[model samples]
Target chain A: MNNEKKKITMMFILIATLLFGLVPFILLTKRSGELQTGNMLGILVVIIIALLAAVIGVKRIKDLKQGQPVEDELSKKVLNVAGARSFYMSLYWLLAIMLLQPVIADILFDSEMLDAEQALGGGITGMAIIWFLNWLYYQKKGVN
Target chain B: MKNKIKELRARYNLTQEDLAKKTGVRRETIVFLEKGKYNPSLKLAHDVAKVLKTSIEELFLFD
Candidate 1:
């Protein structure tokens, strides 16, 4: 795509990789008591792999600058509509979870959950379901 | 809202893809418009009307 689009793509890839990959890795590591030598080695390997991925992503973006336009108006509108619907869906999901947290905990997990950790799993699952519902809505609305 | 996009397309011997390209929209959008499942913005309606060699008023019927 164009330079701006390529830059945007690269930025998106970098942020996504950090958010979905590195953040989880760090969080999982933090769950353990103390870092063993093996854990240190694993962290180092992850860092090296992340760096290599960043380098390749940057190179790919640079190469993409000479390609076609990133998105036309209609495609952007489709995304806007789908994203807005998903936003509403997620908002409702959060509200429902907040309202029914105790009931959900009792019914599903059989626990008297009163903390964020207990609700976190359900919240994530709700978000995933919202995303799927948004996809289905888009499909029904004939958004390509 | 209802539109005469399919009728006009057939009259002009233009496929939905051809009309979509001419109007700078996806075929899905055209399909939705023709089926009355989606309403177009004023600009898109004008663009499609222009590509179909018709006026917006003649192309779309609003209730």
Candidate 2:
């Protein structure tokens, strides 16, 4: 199969594996209300499948048989612009949040408003948005 | 940026896919280049010019 087909297949497999793992995890968590071996095993299996899907998807899309370059100059430029724009956008939002953190804490009466994990989650969301927007932009830009 | 790729490819009886294969890039890249929507690197310009048997100056008209 071609790259597109391979990607679709990999996504389907990954989604199926995630759903499969999620059901077991939910059931075990509901049954015990505490950490259990089954729950851990289910999460572990999901992670492994997700990793496998990611690796296979990347390999197929790259089509790197002998270290050939997958991206041309235009693609590289587009990616750079996308990454820079995403970083700036995310940074501006984070700074705004930081500036308002004291006020937010006062309003909520909680000093620990946003933790490092929540900040990381915001960054991840920003990255995901950038990835999708970049894909859309390039798909349109590269059309005949 | 404007390019004479479409005209030159017609002259040489080469399709977009053919040129893309020659230059080791995807067909979408050639489409973008032909439409003057994407600026190529010097190396890519050289490679494309070589494939078309013409110079970059003649193939790509910069304004």
Candidate 3:
């Protein structure tokens, strides 16, 4: 498919994912108070996917409007650098979370944390946020 | 790296969009190239040089 067509399809998929994946996950989380490990992980995963889709969808729209290709060499390079940086950052983030799990659980959950699953979910969410932020930064600042 | 993309583009009566279209890249890539903020791949450099009617070595000066 052409870039425009691919982008349009992606936009549709983004909308569908948000409507089905994110909304249902939110509803499920609300229905289940003091979320189970699986529930928390599910919600975080959906949120990360939604966030990434939203970013890419917005970028594609802008590119289409400007008559630019949805994916270009510069964008690819920036994405690679951002992904590498975020992956490295996530390792430290997870390690820090693991070390401070007790305090974090006390502060955030106000109860005993069940296991590493919740921390893992939180770590994954953090990683996604970091990746998104890094991507935006590199896009604006330009990669060497 | 510094490049004469902006100068050469203007000499060729090409806007950033025009150059981008000819080279098959986004206008932002052209802007970045002109600003010397991006290092293009060999293929992109060659493409841009061709569009600007110059050699890659003459277009890009590496310090």
Candidate 4:
């Protein structure tokens, strides 16, 4: 497929591989007390595999960045569309969360829930995650 | 908003990177200008025009 598709597929594959790699640990161990010695090697292997995959993904991105320019008219329009969608919708999502924060906190935690300070911290964290995700998606899919 | 970047670069045979180095803009900024994705600040436009050996009006088409 196209570069966008390839990037998304690679990301999905990486996530799936990571979750699958954790399955054995989840199944075999009930607690830290029950941890087995032999599983250490398995965990190490998973870490290495994850690192290798990350390296491959980063290399792919670097190649794209350094590759010949492709900002033809169509791509530029696509980028603008993508950007408009991402920014507007993502901000809308964030607004919804902020508006619903009290209800969510009351349900998810005791009503002693996050106050302004904690909420602000959590908001910043959420913003960072969303920004990173947006950046990744734009890099993958022409920002549209 | 105005620049003579492409023409100047063509005249000097300087790559975008070379111009970026001389003008202290990121390569991406240079690329952005070349592609017309952005209308840069007056300062940036002037700087680029000055480097490119052309007036801002020559480099940019302001509506």
Each model's lDDT comes to: 0.67, 0.68, 0.83, 0.61
Off by over 4 Å in 1: A3-92, A103-111, A142-144
Provide i-RMS per model in Å. Answer: 4.6, 4.3, 0.6, 9.1
Look at candidate 3 and give me any clashing residue pairs. Answer: none
Deviation of model 2 at A21, angstroms: 8.3
lDDT of 4 by residue, B8-55 (tens): 788989899777667665566677687776566678778788888788
For every candidate, C-alpha RMSD to the true structure in Å: 7.8, 7.2, 2.7, 11.6
Chain B TM-scores, listed for every candidate in order, come to 0.94, 0.96, 0.97, 0.84
Ten-residue stretch with the least lDDT total in model 2 chain B: B20-29
lDDT of 2 by residue, A35-93 (tens): 54334544554555565456546654564453333565655676677666667777776
Cα error, residue A144 of model 1, in Å, equals 16
Segments in model 3 whose C-alpha atoms lie over 4 Å from true places:
A1-4, A7-11, A22-45
Residues B16-43 of candidate 3 have per-residue lDDT tens digits of: 9999999999888998999999999999
Ten residues in sequence with the least summed lDDT for candidate 3 chain A: A33-42
Clashes of 4: 3
Provide DockQ values for all models, in the order shown: 0.20, 0.39, 0.83, 0.05
lDDT of 4 by residue, A1-144 (tens): 776547746875875778686876756674655554334434544565565456546645664566523333333544466556667766776787688887866775546455654455455445444544554555444321
* TM-score top scorer: 3
Task: Note the clash tally of each candidate.
Answer: 0, 0, 0, 3
> lDDT for model 1, on a 0 to 1 scale?
0.67
**Which of the two candidates, 3 or 4, achieves a greater DockQ against the reference?**
3
Where's the lowest-lDDT run of ten residues in candidate 3 chain B? Answer: B3-12
**Residue-wise C-alpha lDDT for candidate 1, range B1-63, written one tens digit per residue:** 787889999999998778877876666677788998777888988999999999999999978
The 10-residue segment with the lowest total lDDT in model 1 chain B: B21-30
Each prediction's TM-score versus the true structure: 0.61, 0.62, 0.86, 0.43
